[model samples]
Target: MKKPFRKKRQGGFTLLQFALVVLVSSIVSAVALNRFEYYREQAEIAAARQVVASLRTSLQARAAQLLSTGRERELQQLASANPMNLLLWKPENYLGEYYAPDPQQIGGAGWVFDPRDRSLVYLPRNARSFSFGSSKLLRFKVEFVRISNKSLALNQVSG
Candidate 1:
């Protein structure tokens, strides 16, 4: 007896299967991109905070040295000067001292000292989640605050 012939099945994915795979891949990519951005912003914020903490400590140490050396009158000047100068090792991102950096000159995430305003400006390169308010740069100033009845401390202020 003769056997009946049967059609051969295709070897590749069907059109609908291919479409589904592409859609799933695109979704995964989008979600991954969003998460990556969030983590990047968080890391930037943490690094900035570390720099600020170091600055505060250095300021206090310098003030103490001044007091010990009978240069108490110069503490006020120290508070007004560039805080970065007190750092034994500056961050790699620091763009160095700038009187008043032109917007066109500074274009990236880094630290800069603007003596004109007596503020340290942090220019965020990838600031998707940072709270910059009205401007892209986050500004901080160093000032002396009374910690107790007879003691003062150096602190960083956004204002």
Candidate 2:
């Protein structure tokens, strides 16, 4: 008597197939994570740059007003009251000081005036603060350079 026919069985994936799928997925996830991190950093850098630009414009406008109005003494007083006014234009490391100029503090450390060009320079602390949500805080440096009136004119500097 002939034996009943046996049937072949094929259903779930083999071990090799499962491992390949897992490996591919892990690689894809890693690449995606790396790209995301790069974009985050780029965004942070751009924000920092924008803050610097705004500060520069503000300082320049103030300087021009003082020069055009012949408010040298007031400017000096303001500088003395807030030394950071000068240093804010210069590119430097953040030091955490944001005092406005005062007459008494004029011509001190972190403050310099170009007599020939009639420009003042200083550095201020907390010039730029970047936050990622409520978690991270980043600080940036700012530099100020005041050229003489003649040089300023030649360069067509605008406030």
Candidate 3:
């Protein structure tokens, strides 16, 4: 007696196919995450730079006004009236403090001045060593070396 014979075929993907899919997905995810981190770091750096630039401009404008009008006291008053306590200029406390001032007050971080040396410092969210250089003549440079939870250093120079 001859009976009909039939073979059933596999219905789903093989183990190798599944593994390849997973591998590809993992690679894609890793790339995305890396790109996200890079962008995040770049944004932080840009923000820090912007803060430095704004402070430099303000200081230069104020200094020029003071020299032209001989209103040194007005400039002092402007510095003192900083909305954030971070701008308390003192030689002993070069890194005065860090305050996230209202956006309307100051777009980014706060800053202090060393009236003696005419050097400007930009304080980050914490009392770290994040600072920039500014002279009475408005010449300035902003540096960023590293930033962490507790300490920050502006030891890098960029052209």
Q: Best-fitting candidate, measured by lDDT?
A: 1
User: For model 2, how does the per-residue alpha-carbon lDDT over 1-159 read when each residue is reduced to its tens digit?
Assistant: 999998989799899999999999999999999998777666655654554465556656676788788875555444333323544454343233333333244433233333333333332222233333332323222233465651111111221
Q: lDDT for each of the candidates?
A: 0.78, 0.46, 0.44
Poorest 10 consecutive residues by lDDT, candidate 3: 150-159
Those runs of model 1 whose alpha carbons end farther than 4 Å from true positions after fitting are: 2-7, 126-128, 132-136, 148-159
Q: Report per-prediction Cα RMSD to one decimal.
A: 2.7, 12.1, 12.6
CA lDDT of 110 in candidate 3? Answer: 39
Write the number of the candidate with greater lDDT, choosing between 2 and 3. 2
For residues 1-159, write the lDDT of model 3, one tens digit per residue.
Answer: 997897979699899999999999999999999998767656655665565544555555555666577765554555444312222332232333324223234444434443433344443433222333431111223222223311112222221
lDDT of 3 at 63: 51
TM for every model, in the order presented, reads 0.82, 0.46, 0.46
Model 2 spans > 4 angstroms off: 1-12, 77-146, 150-159
Candidate 3 is scored at a TM of 0.46
